[model samples]
Target chain A: MDEVRNVIELKDVTKDYGDFKLDRVSFAVPEGTVCGFIGQNGAGKPTTINLILDVISRDAGEITLFGQSVDRNSAALREDVGVVFDEMGFHEFMTGRDINIMMKNIYRNWDEAAFFENLRTFSLPSKKKCGAFSRGMRMKLQIAVALSHHAKLLIMDEPTSGLDPIVRNEMIGIFREFVMEEDHTILLSSHITGDLERIADEVVFINGGRIVLTGNKDEILEKHGILKCKKEDLPGISESLIVSSEVSSFGAQALINDRASAEKLYPGAVIEQAALEEIMIGYVNGKR
Target chain B: MKGLILKDLMCLKKQLTTFVYVMAGTVVISILYVLSTRYGNLARVGEQLLDQNNGMSRVDVKNLGSEAMVLFMFLPIVCVGDLMNVFVADGKAGFYKVSSSLPVPLYKRVLARFLTIYTLFGLGVLVDALLAVLLCSMTDIMSLGQFLGVIFSGASILSIYSALMILYCVLLGYGREQYAQVLALLTMAAAFVIIKFDSVRFFVVHVLGDGVGFDSSVFWKPLDFIREKGYVLLGIAALVSVCSYLLSVRIAERKRGVI
Candidate 1:
């Protein structure tokens, strides 16, 4: 692995919560690339991010952020990494200006002018208390803070979960600009696959606490295809190659991992490109 | 650290206003009671302690001081509320994780909260002392030395109480509404028991009012005993503060995801 080029890397990370276990997982986000962490509600995306942040301890395996072991240099590593949670985590009584002042004290690289400019860009009120802000506004404030600090790496957990389409589109553009700088990178986790498809360079899909797929977004979409065939032709398809299959009175639809191989084997079947959502659903169903 | 302290102080300003109002009310009532009983006509008493049969005699200056101390207990309770407010506010706003995740050490954060609460408590005590002195000057009942002693004693006791409150707030983790109600009930019960039982009265006297010439020697004797034992109590309070801080740090480190 090219460790030098990788900003965040997790190797065989495992966290056990008695009844629920985050199984051995491995993935890496290359420097200057956006890695989309795709998973369902209980797919352990938050758990993995938590482990990487050292917010929660893992049972086994090593995590390296900024080319240093997380445990050995967590405080220093955190200085350069900006994190945004799905929910806004700030005192309701504090205004955006108050937050800027407080955060400036924490991060030596925190720029007040940049923070205020971003707040203006996001159209957030500087003096209004956070409690008065709507959900979209709160998320924008969080992002504004995350970007104002000169953090080299950004880790966001479902930052756009409930945002309106327009705000989501705007945020996606901001994220694109964020990674334009050579040293900056982002690892974004969200259940919304459509946004990931539009922004992510690499896609890592997790299901039931395990990594089901990891590859380039375009490559994964290009290789995986949905085959629509008659019910009688379903038996002709090999179960080993089908990730998942939906049966109906009219026909059977199956998701195949390798379109080229499936096409060679089943010449009569109709194949179409599968969206990221379809691929996620097929992998989560574990039909293969 | 400066920013954290400023934030804490800004959040506490409203509660500080309430404390000032309560202290002012206490001083006004004390002045009214003194005037109604002892010095209704300041011209009548000429080197003689006014005596009355089956009615209020010249109010015992020491007993008056003890009453003043009782009034000041609210200051510490209010200070405790200030400390607890930080936790409750953060918990309500979902900001605990955000603040804890900062590079600043958890101990420093806890210390900042403590300093804010105690500094406010100190200011409350100063206001109470000023009010008491003003009331005493109007009543012509106590000397400057005696007034200063009462203020110093009241502040010392408040410091210990504020420390205990900080420890309690940390242990409870913002789930203190029920605990607070139960504690109020227990305090009322204890007050009733002490008032009704002569033995308990005697114990209170021996502990708080040994040398203080108060009509209710029962209350001041035990307080005097407590004052004598102030170092030990203060030590315990300091130890509790340190332990609670360490426990809070451990909790912060173990927390995963968001709270």
Candidate 2:
């Protein structure tokens, strides 16, 4: 078997905006995996994405894409990288054909046939102005542009936000098809944990400009559990195990980071597997 | 880099359509004025201005047609030559995010904008040159060289203004294009006043004083300078554009992601 190679790497990356700072952020996404960059709004998600793309200057540390420093020939390295932002960044007057024309000149590997085909696959009208497109259609147009080029890596910041479920699912299907190739990778950043939960092979959780948790998705989900017990019994549980807890009229529940340890410590306590949403919320609440 | 220029042109599509209209108008007006001076109502006016024997010379009186044509041509070459709309359109669309993500170096990105100014000016000058050849062939209003010289002078001046505007646009960022335009004009005006302060003061005190008469040299001297020395303006425009492009590239690279 071949040794797994990382597609994207950030080592001690730091960007300070005075009010909020991404503090020495470090993470890696191996090839052939969808790494869900989970964070709430204003949780340094877009900033991190911008830094990775070399769109913004960083105060400290380094970023590497395709095993090369972003500072050196960063523009050339983007030949294989496809980027999507939450809001459509294209001009309103531009049609799908217009984008294809502009992008064909910009990217060395731009496939004109593939671009129109992607438009067809997404049901986006080739002649209609993008300004007339609905929010969902606008996103689809961006995705179509991203996929038209033979890009090996996709970096998206909140691409699925504000879309209807059906459209979001359709986008997920497109992303799934993209990752079917062994070398393709996606670093999808969004607050929608459900979408990430359904497709992400790895997860990197961030809160308040800091990486709070990260690892394999299955391992993270398997390790975290919601422990339900009486308010009186909650005090007996180790503080190390409780990520966060809330007490109610009838009982108290705690988000236990070490579910197995909690289980061994209290045999009477009822523990249920925590969803990605529960884990995210528990971690966010724990931060506050 | 070609892609970025194409995108900027797309943003300026409205200006392009308007440019065509202005070109057609300049041609129509120049032809109509030439015909009027030769056989129509303007002929009578020219004869009277010459007959009255004012402080104006026969050369000055004869240049009335050329002066009108130069002013008319200035409308297209100077006022219509702005690339400010591109910045406004880019800002409104938030294209900075998209442009920054492309596989283009920041210096090339800045060069594309500077090149756009020349592209528009090139088109304008080309059309004006063709028109000049046609019009000067049939009439004595102005020689072809003089017409081209004046047109190029206008283009060079506007290019300088546009070059400054590009620098200001990058420094100030979006939603402030109006300020950039004003600052460019002010900078040009300050440079002119600083460079030719003595000439300006002499003209004000000796030419335009209360008892002083209308000095036809006031008008004809500058026209002669523009006709004979327009290359100076072109050289200055090139120098200003080079400086602006270098500074814009540095600022844009430092700011990172701003167009």
Candidate 3:
């Protein structure tokens, strides 16, 4: 495998907020790859993003973006980075045209033509206030702004959480288009595993502020498997291979961390490839 | 920096009507002060004398001075109000957090806000001085020298007050909103207490109460001190404004949240 360059790197990042602590989390997003940041509510997704953006200071750690320290490059290097929060982060009173004008002044490389083109393509009126926009429309507007700035890295948090299926698909398609340039990267944080499954090249799962899994999507899927066997046989299976399991009167379905070992050990049972959602659920359930 | 300032200006564009209303209110209040002082008939003095048991209808010059004080008093309020409008609008709409994600430096963001508030405050002071000069002349309430003194002294005091108000708004912008309110009340209390002191009250009355024909013997010493050192006071106000701005920028840079 060719060594890929990382565009976003978090090394031993830690943040303490009295009630919760993000304990020494570390991950890297390679260039041109869609890195899905998977976590449940209160799992420190926003906190990490905030630290990267310097919206809040980090307690301890080093974050580098675009080959520069985030602390030192906050102003200069941010020109090549785009960010979209779960909320639109725009004044509801502003129209799309207003935002375009504002962005033109804000980003030196802001492509006015591209922004307008996006508005037209999205069927969003340039003069209409964003307060009147539908949830999908708001998400589209943010995506448009993120793309128009000539950003090398796009960081988005929950960009598709509330969107309808069609809109989410459209957003995914847009992400695919963005990554086609071979230099563009995306750090997309979403709870919707299906969207990540469709588009993400790499996945990083975070639970309780700690990274549980980080690797290529295909490898993770291949390494973990679901083994179905009689309920009585679950206790007899090797505990090391079992991530988590569900036992019922009819049978037992267990998620195995190592598929080859599980297949070798349970010769009579059926083993199926685990989806990303199941893998995440298995880890989460295992913690309990 | 220009972009950040432009964003604030764009946000303030919606407040044009409010600006007009505030100016109109200032004019009405100025006119009332002029009428109450120059045209006491408007206060219904003759009717008050006829209705009351006492036949004497003395014009309450102190009351008129208080009313005139309110006209200048409104300066700080308008200054504070305009600054609040820009910050509150950005905050309530979540654009402040959005700005943190942009390429603009945090210092520039803080500087933009300081510039916006002080720029508007400076403009307000100019308009206010002009209004005072015109109304005082039209009513023949005070001599030209006294009006000049009024302009110099009033502008200096109001500038300091406006700077303090900006500091309060900066606190609010940095999300110490509860502290902002406390600071505002405390500042107001301190201002009133300071004003009640003989020296400060004498200076205030010498400038603002010139039209009321105040007997200067009681405050002659402080009044003379202010006249000689008036320019120094202006310098002090300028110094305070600059220091407050620097402090605000420092606080804003270290702020942890958007609001």
All candidates in order of TM-score, best leading: 2, 3, 1
State each candidate's clash count.
Answer: 12, 0, 0
Q: What share of the true interface contacts does each candidate keep?
A: 0.52, 0.80, 0.75
Better of 2 and 3 by TM-score: 2
| Best model number under TM-score | 2
**Candidate 3 lDDT by residue in tens digits, A162-239:** 999999998899899999999999999999999999999999999998999999999899999999999888899999
State which candidate, 2 or 3, has the greater DockQ: 2
Off by over 4 Å in 2: B211-214
> Which is the leading candidate under DockQ?
2
> What is the C-alpha interface RMSD of model 2?
0.8
Overall lDDT per candidate, in order of appearance: 0.74, 0.89, 0.77
What lDDT score goes with residue A29 in model 3? 95
- Quality of candidate 3 docking, DockQ: 0.60
- Candidate 2, residues B37-73, lDDT tens digits: the string is 8898998887888788775566886766778878866
Per-candidate DockQ values are 0.42, 0.84, 0.60
**Can you tell me which runs of candidate 3 are displaced by over 4 Å?**
A1-3, B24-81, B126-182, B191-233
Assess chain B of each prediction and give its TM-score.
Answer: 0.63, 0.95, 0.63
